[model samples]
Target: MATQAHRTKPALGEREMIVLMALLMSLQAFGIDAMLPALGQIAGEMGADGNDRQFVIGAYFLGAGAGALFPGAFADRYGRRPVLAVSLIAYIALSIACALATDYTMLLAFRLIQGFACAGLSVVPAAIVRDHVGGDRMARLMSLIMMIFLLVPILAPAVGQGILYLAGWRAIFGMMAVMGVLVGVWAWLRLPESLTEENRQDINLFPILRNMGTALTNRGAIGYVVGSALVFGSLFGFLNSSQQLIAETFDQGENFYLIFGGAVVGMVAANFTNSRIVERFGARRVGHAALLALIAISFAQLWSASQPQQPLYQFIILMSLSMASLGFIGANFSSIAMQPFYHIAGSASSAQTALRMSTGAVLGALIGSLYDGSAKPLAVSMLSCALVALAFVLFSERGKLFGRKVPSPD
Candidate 1:
């Protein structure tokens, strides 16, 4: 094996490429988040129980986690484009399956498949970026990608809400199907294969597994990925319970979507700030600082919720601040975790993504189970996850989260 020299040149223009990649990658997160307001309606329509309805969300993420593992190997062997194209095609079909389902079991099964299909779109873009840029430049590109990706959370809930008002829960799936088809066509036409034949490895499960094992063993990689996963799982917990929290606890009634949109605005603002600062400060520095902020906010929110006379406005404020920190943590954590294994970037990306989603699914389910018509479960979960993340960062970087040399792209 040969070591490649680090190169700083960007493969594509920043704005357009970032927007396209972000939009493609965000489909997975948006699919779950946007549907929050409609989860109850879907449950009723499908005759699902409370816990089973939550499974609809859980199963999708579980599928995404499982699906991510294989695509890295496939992308390494064949190329990103083919795997991506196939994934989008599967996304469209699964979305249609979701739309056509008449029972809870069918919807749950389709959602699982849809989650799996989304993995290619979600994971390949990051690997493609790693192919072109490394270190701070990589962090900047990721920040840009995340800045664009933030729009999905900003807009998707409103979009889903509008569809729900016009045609009900099933129409949300129809819209997803349309979005998938359009993105698929666009990808087929505009996106060139980033992984060239020269860079492609032979197809083999053993090698891929070996690479995944290597990634899992790397201390820095495991720390960043696991730390990030806890943070992501906290976010997942919020998504799982946001609708209920707003409607039941806050009594937001028909305005729950607007409240959700407000939280997304906080996220977008953070991403924009990250895009500007991540290059100068480095991903670890910015991410670790942001994680500390998250921990503080989480604890404050938990404390506030414990009060006897907590106001809805106060709850909203805390939720907004907590979500704002996510913008900083999400992209930077991913970039840092992917820093060490350029030789097996594809597999490393796969393992990291899998860990993030799998852990998120478990945490989300646990939080969902703890939902009690109040914000306590969400706040507690967030605080606990944030503390865990802080500990992981300390261990991963050996208490040196900042002032480290940024690795250049090879």
Candidate 2:
């Protein structure tokens, strides 16, 4: 069990800490979203064909998943600062390596390694937040963090495109390395340790493994992790195939970023609203409704896609609705998943995060590979994921659906 010796908040101011965590988490999103505009250029230069281009995104997520299981445990043993510092340095180095790649396979390899480093960014912040708070407050904090974290998606493609025009796609990667340095310096100088000395543990293989097993075996919390994976796989599928579908199927290549950003605005709004309402309505109640809404929106997307000469307006509107539903679902579901564990926060986070990423990455790559110059595949996959996710939710709730079963107090 985790020592709960330093459960009080850190020394950093709440606002500053929130913003810092926001940037740390957003770096991973920026890494993926910022490169969307350049996938075609990379493909053309390196002779990638068919759905092969999507491998660039797939490789990164796969590496992150594979590397995620270690960071949290390491942070628990060695302190968050050392683990985060090493990860940031690695992220900076790998970003440079990616920029220097000369072929498609080489670029994919670098991206895979870079993603490994970025896993620290994903696991540590959530663990750190969990170190101090839990339940609905954690959910509200996560919603705010997500509100800021998600801004990367809204603006990244445009930033990448601007760099692609002004300097080159490779320059976008250079910017990423520079940003990593800036964030690293900020963290090193200002961010105090969230895991205090008393809570630090010795590196023991058995305890670590046991804690991971405990977290993964939780009947209620672990169910949400699987459901979250399935739902997020749909989002990942959209990311993997987004550029191609937006540019080709919709005949909006030139306005790709604008249209994409506009749709993501719905997500931003939903998250902001979720932050306001989740504490009042409870996580499960709100998230379950949003999950159902996502399923409905996906069905509407299928119907829209089947119609001849469907207007881009219709498609974007339906997609925006789906994205909005995801906004409500993400924060609330994660909070519910994390609600059951406090003492094993780091190990639990590590195990669950690794599972979600690995499963989502594989499923997303498969969905992307099914692209055939149309939106049909994406719509079908999303609806299927939603249905499966709902089943997991039902299993988690013991066939119940709505109302909050609050975890025992921290």
Candidate 3:
């Protein structure tokens, strides 16, 4: 395996790249968050139950995971810009189809494909960053991207709620389509190809399989990937059940976006803090500490959930704290996982994200399914995911915890 040292310098400025990457990647979150306020509207119109409603979100993740498994190899073979352009085109088309769907099944299918198209946004941006930098630099850049990316969750639900107030749920999809088109046009016009000709691989199956296998076998990479997936499961579980928890369980239907945005403040602060400190602390050290914090918070949330008629404020505080810890875990864990696979960044990113999205989606759907007019299921699943993530991190470290390894990208 060879590194990307011989490639021509990236054309885009760092700030420009960060803004572009954050915008493109936010599409996935926008798709999910913006629809949150309309889940009840979707359910009522579709004549579906609570469990079925969760699939509107889960299906997209499943498609994203499934679709993500291959595009990295394609990007490695072709180039980042072309693959991204094609995916954005597909994303726009599918989002439009989603808006026009007359039934639940059609909407679900369109969303799945839309998510599949959105996979390029997930893999390519990370690969592009890996292409330009490595080690702690990569971690810092990723954290910065995440710091900006966190704004989507903070604002998207509100946007979705506003859209719902002005129009129907279908118009939300229309808005997604418009955004996808605008992004596609911007990327086509300004985004330069990040992968160099020297690093380009042929679209051959054997090497793709071999490289993927090698990435999967790397102890550090796979460990962080799985750990991140478990942690993401907690976050996704919250997203899957949040609307009901806010609207019905807490009787705060009108205040859903405000409460949700308030919780996101903790995440925003954590991401900013991680961005400032990750280079000095190392991605693994910061992530490990955050994982511990998450476990502790999860236990506190679990205990609170066990009590009868838990105060909404108490629940919000614990949830906010958990998300705060998670903000550190997510981007750092991802940067660490991608560190060892610089040569195969595309394939590695695709595989890692595929696993993470699929696992989180499944775990979240399971937790959501267990919603029984209380928050116990969400608390139980979140605690379990956090503990499992900690276990994986410990195992990956082989008993060593806070030490930072010198990055070897050969």
The residue ranges of model 1 lying beyond 4 angstroms of the native Cα positions read 1-12
For model 3, how does the per-residue alpha-carbon lDDT over 1-410 read when each residue is reduced to its tens digit? Answer: 11233336655688988888988898888999999889999999988786688888888888888888878998998888877877788877888898888899988988888888778888889999999888877888887888888899889999999999999898888898899888777777667777877788887888988888777778877778899898888788889889999998899989999988887778878888987988787887888888888989989998999998988998899999988998998888888888888778898888888888888888878888888889989999989988888788877788678877436352
What TM value does model 1 have? 0.95
Better of 2 and 3 by lDDT: 2
| C-alpha-based local distance difference test score of model 3 | 0.84
Count of steric clashes across candidates, in order:
0, 0, 0
* Each model's lDDT: 0.80, 0.86, 0.84
Candidate 3 worst ten-residue window by lDDT? 1-10
Model 1 CA RMSD to the hidden true structure, in angstroms: 3.5
User: What TM-score does candidate 2 get on C-alpha atoms?
Assistant: 0.96
Taking every candidate in turn, the Cα RMSD to the unseen true structure, in Å, is: 3.5, 2.5, 2.9
lDDT of 2 at 229: 90
Clashing pairs in 1: none
Better of 1 and 3 by lDDT: 3
Runs of candidate 3 with Cα error greater than 4 angstroms are: 1-7, 405-410
Task: Candidate 1: count the clashes.
Answer: 0
In model 2, which regions exceed 4 Å deviation?
1-8, 405-410
